[model samples]
Target: IFFVSIKLTVPLAYFYILLILVRELCEKFPGSLYIPIQTYLPYLASVVSTMQKSSTFVEVWAIIEALFYICLRLHIQWLQYKDPLEASLSSAPMLELWERRQLWERIMEIETDDPVSFVTGWFFDQDLQHITRYDVLDFVAWSMFEGRNQEHLTGDELGQLHDFVDELEWKISEHLNRSDSLIPEKNTDKNEVGDNRKDNQETPITSEFTQEKNDLDLSDGISSPRRDQGDRPRNQFRFPENVDDDSPDFFTNLYENYHNWYEQTKDRLENSDFHPVQGIRNYMAEKRQQIVEKEKNAMATASNLAENAYNRLVSPGSNMDKQLMALSHATQSQLMDAWNSMVEMKERLETAKFVSSKRKVLQQQLRGYRHLLDSARAMSSAIPSNQMADLMRKITQCNEAIERVEWSARDAFVKATGYARKNILQRTEPQRYAKYSHDPLLGISTYPLMFHLLILGVTDGGLRVILRRRGFERRTMGPIAYYFHPGSSDHTEDENEELNDEDREMTPIVFCHGIGIGLLFYLPLIDEMLRLGRPIFLPEIPYVTGFRPWQSP
Candidate 1:
């Protein structure tokens, strides 16, 4: 009977979806559509359907209603796919629990499934990857999807990603406008190109290296030119010496291999239109620029110290010069060592595709590429003069769309992407970190950045690392806060507990959140803490979100 009536039921199902959509619209904006008071026909239809007996008129109208819904749905689906940018994602499907958990976990850096979600298998495909929405999608569907989300972005999550990308582009553009500080002799415009071209020319690195060779040669010609090794500072900061002569760190070795991998994938670019490779390349360019700035900052700090030492060295105003002179020598010698080490370190960094080979990483990265990369590469492939203009328009459109996102939308966006999570459980393979548990993922310098701020941590990814380091299992936390808290200390079954505590502790941490989080904001956090064997008590903050005005007094 079910198979025989497939056509009948399928049309009804389609109609039901549209009916809900229309009902939502009507309820949301009753006056905007200016429908007559009789616009309540759908409700009457629903009520009549519930009646014990229906008239012939009702039966006839039901079939008509189903057809009308089918047409509306077809029109909507057609419109969605007509936009090339939108069409790619049309087949991406809805989020699945596992994929959504993974994506949300990867982004937020934590594992909590407060509100379970599912990411469609289509969207998960690396072969048919969509980068645009992946790159910028943090929008909560009902903030559009949920009743909550503050709707802090451009009306939704999609808008938030656009806004974030625009801000970053503007910053990148600004950086390019300024003079390149890395190679002081050449302007930034030439310097970046020069650095990249080194592989092509097979030239020896650095004009500085050439100059140093000349100075060495000249000094040798004069004879008796051996500088004092005694002058070298050993006790203080020392750069890694003999890097080429010595073994490389794991990061360096891995990156070197990755570069070779990139070369291997060069053909893939030609075959697949080279869009994804181009996205990775753009990301690498941005990262490379950042690396340059970091190097410059390090050098400038060393040079400033050197200058200060020179002032103290000849002055000899007091006994302090002894320490100051030592300090200066240490700083200068360390600087030289650093330059040498970096030259060695440079050998390890390869422009290789990493996240590419890994499926999970690929999906996440592809999401970042989708819409923007398609436009960018298309623009880049275009001929020069007109290319710049087209690129500018695309960029401007992206920027305008981003700037339009409101704070409420931002809040909603974060909620959608798992940024606004409080407590929950996520099933993931155990993360391997540290030689031993309890080693913090963040160094003290980096840790404070994740602390209380006007904004939230971009995602729970970092928080998750912290949780895993603390020795709590995410999904394995048993029924009780301590499944066996009062058990004997020697129980091998209880590896999660920190047996070393003085036993007077209540919890490892306590957080005070802005109000109106409505217990939901903490679902993720609560799950994380419990997994880590830590209990958290969340108190309310005054003059904050979600609190009543009368409660403030």
Candidate 2:
């Protein structure tokens, strides 16, 4: 997600620079470039260009044509940086803008195969270094040529917008399609449906419906995909507790038969310190945590610097140059802070490098830890597995989040997608994050849409569309991380203490109420659904305000 956004921003930022130049130019010219249509038309009429004896009216017509050409060119170029609203647009601008908007929207909707991380493409063979930034640059250059002295967006910003959108989309989709991917597909039931319309294609599902595209129709009515239904194929999707072959357990058991392989793969070294699956996880987790904390601290510090810069910029009577200078200064400060942190961490690690002579002892300890984690990561519940009905219920809850962002911030969202940022204001507000009573059953509701959005790493139009229908604005917005409290080997969480009935089926529970209404208002009901049995991670929430003032780029 980060790389994608960076890739996108480079061009947008460049274009923004161009826009800044245009704005400065127009400000200098005043009536010459930015006059009203009335004033504009009269000026055009004053120019004389006719070869056939220049009469006042003839000369006026010639001047008007010249000015009209100029204005038309400007309008076309300005529209080139089309907004995300293109998908919903009823009309389009001239060639440059229209084509560019279409291209961007297509990029925005690009979907990747799941289980592949959003960062995957960016990292493949260090794809970032090899990535040509030209796709965005070309479109941007075209937009700036004749259009409004500026585009609705600068190219760099538009690129960043694309990355931002992509990342959010990836995170949201990931959250929805969790290993326990049941939510989004439940209502959109054609998942199992094969394309019956495709000739010679074997349809795996059994019922009236056919193909994934049949989603909208099936929810309205119960239309099974497979018509030639005999004995329904038993679910290939193996449950962990009630283990199925397709389940990880299926391979795990096979891998276990090769017990030594599970303990120590040949690739790691015959007597490598790296223990099998479990030990690596622990090592990775600890290492990852260290990285995360450093990152968080850096971001916090950078944010502080940005806030200070913004404060200075917005002081009344500050000139445009002052604001630009502040933006430059703030950006530099943040970058320097991040670089210093990274360097410090790198040096410390380098200096305290592990002693190789102790490798043998470390290997032994690693083996032990690895085995423990392998057992831990895979431990299924000893208790009876959750009922199918319960799982289905949670799936339904997650489905709701898939469409919530569409209508609420309709314009803001659409505009943001195309780089229409006016200034930074939070989408949600800062307040104490309200802690909710933990209902293991409410795991579905608490799964955290904002987290999911951030995790999947992008927001599409869906959330806003749903939000508008509900008529709620983003009262308070901010990032939130809901901790999923640890459970036993299986994925279940504890029931809310107040609501006794120990035997009552409880799924893994996560609590999220914090800072603003973004998480509090939108998430609760959804989290209630996704809880499974034990082996849960305890819930922890960390967030910053929805927005903080930063120098505008």
Tens-digit per-residue lDDT, 1-553, candidate 1: 6333543554554454455555556566667641543365656545433442435564555555565445545544554344332222232333333443345335332212211112112224321112222222222221121111112122223343333333222222222222222324444467666664343222222221111111222222211111211121111111112222211123323443656665666667768766553575577679879989998987777978877776766566666767877898998798677666645433322222321233234334434434544454345343343332343345444433432332223333344345643432222221121211112223211111112221233223443454455443334233212211211223334653544554334344556554453334655766555554444444334324332222221
Residue 224 of model 1 has an lDDT of 14
Compose the digit string of candidate 2's lDDT tens values, residues 400-488. Answer: 22123222233333333454445422232111111121111121111112233453333223444443343323322233223233333
Best candidate (score: TM-score): 1
Clashes of each: 50, 95
What overall lDDT goes with each candidate model? 0.37, 0.35
Q: Local error of candidate 2 at 98, Å?
A: 30
lDDT of candidate model 2 versus the reference: 0.35
Question: RMSD per prediction, one decimal?
Answer: 35.8, 34.3
